[model samples]
Target: MKNLFPILLMLIIMVNASAHGGKNHEHANIFENLQGNNKAAILMVHFGTTHDDTRALTIDALNKKAQAEFPGVELREAYTARIVIKRLGERGIIKQKPQDVLAQLKKEGYTHILIQPSIIIDGVEMESLQKDVVEVQSQFKEIRIGDPLLYSPEDYEKLIDVLTKNIDSETAYIWVGHGTYDSNTAQYAMLDYMLKARGHTNCFVGTIEGYPSFDDMHQQLKASRLKKVVLVPLMFVAGEHAKNDIAEDWKNDLEKEGYSVEVKMEGLGQNPEVQDLYISHLKFKSAHRKIGIIEKKAIYEVTGEKME
Candidate 1:
């Protein structure tokens, strides 16, 4: 009876740790080893949006989760979208440019630093961030930039699992993403392929400005024989793209094509699992500041999962 008491106590402790974030403290300790001689800090950069409501649910939630993960780290933020920054400034909400924020961090004497972007793809924003990193390179002792989401095959696996966590296997999910002309836009196609590759045949991906346009999506669905489809934005905020583009424009198009279209007016950032992926990216960078590249199985949370 007394031995059973200790076993029950151990089980309770394991449950609490797993629920809160398994190995969270271990990851935090490893991140601490990334710090150099000087004070350490993080700059979480993102493409700022104008809609404050979705901004709260998506961007705000993501940042807050990052803060929770690094409870003691000095954290800051910057916005890549100058138009949105200017608009917010006009509304009396002040935000800084990514380069300007990087410069200020340098001035503040934070030697060991990490710039973690919340960007989903490796595109224009990443190039922009690289330029900023170069401009500020001489000022800091060690300044590392975390890779954007979807940099590896394991990333796609994690993404598919998280994005489809609440989705029905029977229904088709048409993910609408903001597109780019750069080579990295192939990610959208790979995402679609991963869905089909993993037996999630009901999932499809299309972009606002990339390959597999609306026509492609229509054709894909036309063959599927599924009458009802849900449009979910593969974006950060459920803002203009999700609301007007996916829900309205795509919705109208699909309905006209003789299909029942449903809009799941939520963005990728709204997913707790997705936000954790971003947080894990930051942690992975911190853990591997000396390595400069990711080791596939070590950092990504979904390395060995058997998919549905």
Candidate 2:
């Protein structure tokens, strides 16, 4: 009976230890599943350019960012640039068509897809992408689409912050926007407010198509005594504007005008924070899923709020 008493006590201790360990394990499982069990698929849709280097760089940057943020999620790219995609295939930059890439992603165990468009503003490409997302959602009900980076005013703030990083007070930061004749110029107008808020005295934002012209730029350059200028394309890929127009053609005119202009073209998509725009979208889509929110609204949209 004495020996049996010690054995019974030891058994009770073992049972308690097992119970404690079991509770911890169960708690860990709950924490993991609280987020969700489904694997996320990310599709980075861009208005792709035929410019091989530019397209490659833009897609590569998007992929890199997605890999860094959602290491476990599946990632793919779809281009709206049909001509560019065809040219990329000829140049061997892209091996398969956009449809083929979509099929491959579907085959993977990706239950939820987050579509992120790289369009700068609500242009024709953006409107078309919204339609595509609607069609894709009808086919893949499981895929929940996130808002485009520029869809909301919050996104513009992020863009402003990103641009501010590459600019200094000594240099005038000029952005080249792709504008349309029909639409309201409200998008480009935001730049003036943002720059003013940043205390940038010499910053200007204008479009390639309509209102703001290079002639205007030449006039400003001549008038400015700052003497240092940085010209960056607001375009996703620094395609034709960056290579031919700004760096090459514009240089000849500016040089002849006797203003020492330093031209540097940085693709807005290449900026690291721009990737966070997508990350923010993913977090918004996957809030209930196990992942913790790293940054809450890193870019907040201001609608109906006056920008001083």
Candidate 2: stretches off by over 4 Å: 1-40, 51-56, 95-111, 216-225, 288-308
Q: What is the C-alpha lDDT of each candidate?
A: 0.79, 0.62
- Give me candidate 2's TM-score against the actual structure: 0.70
Return the lDDT, model 2, position 58: 74
TM-score to native of every candidate shown:
0.82, 0.70
Backbone clashes in model 1, listed as residue pairs? none
lDDT digits (tens) for residues 85-163 of candidate 1: 9999999999899888877877887777788888888888899889988887888777778777777788999998887
Best by lDDT: 1
